[model samples]
Target: MTEKIAIQTKNISKRYVIGTKNSKPNTLAGEIINFISTPIRNFKKLRSLSNNTTDNTKTIWALQDIDLTINEKEIVGIIGSNGSGKSTLLKILSKITIPTTGEALINGKVGSLLEVGTGFHDELTGRENIFLNGTILGMNKKEVEENLDKIISFSGVSNFIDTPVKRYSNGMRVRLAFAVAAYLEPEILIIDEVLAVGDSSFQKQCLGKMDDVAKSGRTVLFVSHNMESIMTLCTRVIWIDEGKIIKDGDPVSVVNEYLETTNTISETNINLENINKRGGDGSIKFTNLTIMDKNQKEKTQFNIGDTLNLSISLKAIEKGLLNSNLTIKILIKNQNNTTVLSFNNESYNHFIKLDDKNNKIQFSIPKLPLGQGLYSISLEVWVNGGKADTVGDVGVFESTPGDFIGNGIPDQEHSLFHTNSVWS
Candidate 1:
C-alpha cells in the first residue's frame, strides 16, 4: 500500500521587495537638480558606479527552492536560526502566506499556532474564542461545546473562561491559544515557536498533548530551537539555512550538524557572543564562554558518563559591592518546550569574585545521563543578591547515544534524563 503524504511542497519560494535610500531626495527642487544630473549619473554607472541599485531597491528571498514531503503520522521538526525561513515554511504550509512561486499541498485540515494570541479576539472572552477558533478549524458549534471543558482544563484557564482575552496575561493567552489549536482535532498540526512562552508545567502539558496527537496518527510540523524537543518528538528533521534546506535526515544528526555549523565557539572558545543569552537585566554580560572535555580540548561531542565542563567569562559594568554568583542552568527541552532536564545554580552553584577583571566560572557535570541529542546551556549572574543578568539558549552542544549503565533511573538521576522515560 502506498502511504499518503500529509504535506508536500515543490520549488516553493518567497520574495520581498526592499526600498533603498535615494540621496537625490524627494523635494521638487532636489528632483530638478537630480534630473539635470541624470546624464552624469548614467555616465558614472557606465564607469562602474557603486551599484546604487541596491541603495534604491533590493529583493530578499525568505524561502527558495524548498521541496519537502511529510508522511502521514510523521512528526517533523524544522530547526534553524532566527530568520532562517523555518517560520516562513510553516506559514506557507499552514496557508497563512501564499508562496510567491510553486505550490504547497496539504492532505488534511491544519491547525496552526503560528504566533502568540493569533486567531484570537481580544475583546472576546476565552469561551467565545474557543468556539471561534474551532469554527476556523472547520468544527461546528456543537463540536466546540462538547470539547469546551477539556480545552479549558488543558489550558489551565478555567477561571478565566468568561473573562475577555484582553484581560488575560501573556502566559494565559498562550495557554488558551495552544489549547484551542491542539484540541481542534485537525489531521495535521503546524506549530511555530509559540510554545516557549508558557510556564514550565503548561509546556509539559502541551508536549503531552502533542505526543497524544501524533500517536493518534496525525501529522505534525514543528519549528523550535529546542534541540531536545526536536530529537524527542520528531521522527525526521529538516535544517534550513539562508532560505534553503541544508540537511534533512534523522533528528539527532540534523540537529548536531545545525549546531556545529551555527556555533563557531569550540570546546575551548569561551566567548559571550558565541553563546546563547537566556535572561537577565543586561547589566553584567557574558563576554566569553567555552565547554570542554577532560582533555580540555574544544569538545563538541559527549557520550553517556562523560564529564562535561562549561567555562564562562563575564564582565561587570559600573561595579559596586556586587554579590557575584555564577549559575549554569542546563535545559533539555523537546520541540514542544517539554523540559526533561533543568538544572539551575541552586542545584549546583559555584561562587565567584568579580572586581573589574574578567571572571571565569566553570560547572562540571561528571556524568551526563541524557541520551543522544542536543542540549542548550543557560548562564545567569547575580549582582548584590538580586537577578542581574541571564543568558538562555546561548549555545547548543551535542550528546551522542550511550548506554543506560547507571544504576539510578533516568529522570531521578541527572545522568539519565531521557525525554520519553516513564516513571512507575
Candidate 2:
C-alpha cells in the first residue's frame, strides 16, 4: 500500500500590503470625512489595480513559491527567525488566510491552535468555548457532548470550566485552547507557539498529547521557537528563512543549520542604533553589541575551553536614567532553547551605575562550559522598574567538540557539559 499525501503546496505565495504611514483617520470627524471621500479613493485604487503597478513600498511577500508535500502520519516542525514568515505559513495551511497566488491542497480536516484562546469567546465560559471550538472543527452536538469531559480533563481546567475566559491567565487560556483542538480528532493537526505561554509541566503534557496524535496515524505540523520541543516531538524539520525554505531534513541538523546562519555576528563590530530587533521601552537603547575571544579576535566559533567576551555599548535617552534601578541580564540557551546559564550583577555582587549618557559593559567567561553544540545568546535590560529591552535568539555561536578532560574520546552528544572526573 502506498502512503497518502496529507498536504501539498504548489507555487503558493501570500502578499500583504502595508501602508508606509497611517492612512486611516485618527478622529471621529476625520473618519466621517474620509468615509465621504471613499468614492474618490476607490476610483484611484481601481485604476491602479487594473494595471500591474502598485505602491511598491506597501507590498511584501510573506511566502514565495513554497512547494512541499507532507505525507499522512508525518510530523513536521517549522523553524525560522522573527518575521521569516513561519506564522504566515501556518495561517495559510489552516485556511485562516488565502494565498495571493498558486494553490495548496489539504487532504483532511484541520484543527489549529495558532494563538492563546483561539476561536474562543471572551465572555463565554470555558465549557462553552470548548463546545464552540468542537462545533467549529465540524463536530456535531452529540460528538462534542461525548468528548466534553475528556477535553476538560486533559486541559486540567476542570475547576475553572464554568468561569469566563476573560478572567483566565495566558497559561490557562492556551491549555484549554490546545485541549479543544487535539480532542476534536482532526485528521490534520496544526499548532504554532501554543506552548510558549504554558508552564514547563503543561508544555510537557501538550507535547506528549501531540506525539500521541501523530502516532495515531494523523498528520501534524508544529511551529515554535522552543527548539527543544521541536526536536523532541518532530520526525522532520524545515528551516524557513526570508519567506523561503532554505533547508529541510532531520531535526538536529536543520536546527543547527538555522542557528549557525541566522543573526550571526561575523564582523568585529555590529551596529544597533535604530534597530528594532527587540522589544522594550524607549528610555534607553543599545548602540552596539560585540562578541570576541580573550585575544580580541572576532569570531562566532569557539573551542569548549576558550574564553569568550561579550561587550555591550548603550546610551541613556533621558538624563539621570542610569542612577536608578537599572540592571542588565545575559542568558545562554542550549540547542533546545532551554536556559542553561544566566548572569546578572545582583548574582555576582557586582554593581554598575549609569553616570553618563554613553556606557560600556563587559561580561567575560573564563572558559566556555557548554557541550559540543550551538548555543544562542539572549540579552535584556531593565531600568526604572520596566524592561528597556528583551531579545531572544539574537546571537548564536558554536562550541567545537573537544576532549576538555584527559579522556581518549569526547563526551557523548547528549552530555550538557564536559567536566573532570575523579574515579578511584
Candidate 3:
C-alpha cells in the first residue's frame, strides 16, 4: 500500500521582474532619457545582476524552492507576511499561474475563490457567473445545475441573481463567489482572504461550509490573517516567510510562531494588506496605527502614570458619513491575551464626531492603570449599525514602572490589572 497525497510540490519557484530607478535620474530630461533607454538599461542591468553576484537581483522569487506534501482530507492553513508568497503558492496549485522553475502536482479537482470577482465576468449575470465559475472549476452544465439552487440560496443573492454582476458590490460578489466555490463540491478547496469582503454573518457561514467540506474528506488550503480562525479550523499549518516554507506542522505552534514574528511595536505606517485577520464593510480602512506618549514621542514602553495615546489613521471609502454614524472601540489586553480594559465610543452618543474627512483618530488614556507587562491592543470600528473595520493584535506596548504616587515603584502582576486598594 502507498500513502496518498492531496497536493505536492517539487522545488517549486516563481519569479517576477520589477524596475528600480537609476540614482542619476532626478530631472525630467533624465526621466525621459531613462524611459527611452528602458529596454537597453534592463538588459544591461540583467547582465550586471548575472555577473557572479550571487544576489539574484534581476528577479524576485515570490516562491523559492518550496517542497511539501499535503495528505488527503487534511485541512492545511497557510500563514505568512505580506508578499511572503502565500498567494503565489495557491495560484500555482490552482493552475491560475505556472511556476517559473518547479512543478506542482494536484491530485484532485480544485475549486478556488481567490479574489472577490474571480472567475466572474462583469457582463454576466449573477446566475450565469455562478455556472461560469463552476465550469472553470471543471464542473459541467448538469453538475452546476444540480447545485444551482443551493448556491443561490447560500449566497442570498436571489433578488439579484438575474442582474449583471457588474453592478454588484464587493460584498455581493464575495457572497456569490464563495457560494460557487463551496457548494459545487470540488475535491480540493483553495480560499484566500476574499471572505473578508462580506459581512460577519456570511463569513461565519463560509467558515461553516468549509468545515463541512473538510469533514467530507475533501482537502482544504486556508489562508487567513485571523489567528483565532486558523487555530479553530486547521488541522495542520505551514508558515511561509520570504518565499520559503519555514515551519510546517501543528496549527497552534505554527500560528504562535507567525504572531511572534510580526512587529509588536511599529513606528511607521502599517501595511493593511499584510493583515489577513482584518475585515470590514468597505466603508473605512485603517492605514496606520501608532502608539505614543503625551509628549508626541514614539515608543512602545509606557509608564503606568503616562498618558498613552493611540493614533489610528484611516481613509474614508465614500462620502456622506456623518461623525455620529460611526463608532470606534479600542481595547487592551495583558501578555496572556486577556481583555483587561475596553473603551467604546458609542457611535450615537460619543461627543467627538468623525470628521467624515478626518483621516486620523486618537484614543487617549489619561494616567494609564496597568501593571508591568506586555500588552496588546485591538481595534474595531462600526458605521451605520454595521462593522466597518476590525484589526486584532494591532499593536503591543510595554507597561513599565510608574510613580503616580510619591514612590517610584511599578504595579506588577501577571493577571488582569494592578490596582491600589486601601483597607476599609
Q: 82-175 in candidate 2: lDDT tens per residue?
A: 6778899999999988888889999988877686555789899999998887787667888888988898999888999999999998788888
Report the Cα lDDT for residue 394, model 1. 60
Model 1, poorest ten-residue lDDT window?
Answer: 48-57
Mark the 10 consecutive residues where model 3 has the least summed lDDT: 49-58
lDDT of 1 by residue, 206-264 (tens): 88887888788888889987887778899999999769999999998999887666653
Best by TM-score: 2
Instruction: Show model 1 residue runs off by greater than 4 Å.
Output: 24-57, 266-424
Put the candidates in lDDT order, highest first.
2, 3, 1
Clashing pairs in 3: 225-277, 226-277, 323-354
RMSD of 3: 10.8
TM-score of 3: 0.64
Model 1, residue 375: displacement in angstroms?
12
TM-score per prediction, in order, is: 0.59, 0.66, 0.64
Model 3, clash count? Answer: 3
Cα RMSDs of all predictions?
Answer: 11.0, 7.9, 10.8
Better of 1 and 2 by lDDT: 2
lDDT (10s digit) by residue, model 3, range 155-194: 9989999999999987888888878877667788888866
